[model samples]
Target: MSQVMKPSTAAQKLGILLSAAPEDFQQTPISREDLDALRENPPQWLQDLRRNGPFPRDVIAQKLGVSNSGLARGGLTDPLDADQIGELLANPPQWLEHERSVHRKVVAENERLKAERARQGN
Candidate 1:
């Protein structure tokens, strides 16, 4: 039997985020055969993803110099292309600044706590 891939699984293998994908992708299960077919003869969107990349959220966040949580909090549902990321950096919104601040604070606090714990030997 041909293995069936849920939309989520397909999205992962393709290195794209589920929320970032097109609506049609979310609506169905993709069989392995169909995925193989796409791989052989890519569509425009597939080409774009391959060329720009179906980047995972972590890579996206890091490349953008923001936290993963910041991305989520900013309602960034789509995986960004390099151009999109560049645009955001060129003119970041207030929310992005706020989220970056929050992420920085959280990281600082986490480091402090870890250091404290180590000192206590627990």
Candidate 2:
């Protein structure tokens, strides 16, 4: 005779299956190495879009799945000026603080190089 499965056992098996499923996985944060790579060699699409001008900060922010202010503060939009960079560095939006820190480091390096070049009269 065929036997019926116990509800608890069925539930446990379902839970196990769900947990094992790749589609049920949660997203992890981007790693610093990955972000640095992007900064060093931004994708062709991004370059083309940025050539026109900074994409609308809000739109780019939405595409990146972050808030507009976060994108603005992270220097991810395009062609940010010194004043904007200063404001961002002073008080970054919450979600992008880590990424912003990385960007800040890059910007600082760029500034240091520029200053050194100026000092050398190059």
Candidate 1 is scored at a TM of 0.56
TM-score of 2: 0.27
The per-candidate count of clashes, in order, stands at 0, 0
The ten-residue window of minimal lDDT in model 2 covers 17-26
Q: Cα RMSD to native, each candidate? A: 5.5, 18.0
Scored by lDDT, the top model is 1
Candidate 1 regions exceeding 4 Å error are 1-51
**Residue-wise C-alpha lDDT for candidate 2, range 1-122, written one tens digit per residue:** 33444433332322222122233121333344544453578666434434433334443443344555657565574644335545655766665666545656766899999999999995
**Per-residue lDDT value at 47 in model 2:** 46
Which pairs clash (backbone N, Cα, C closer than 3 Å) in model 1?
none
CA-lDDT, candidates in order: 0.79, 0.47
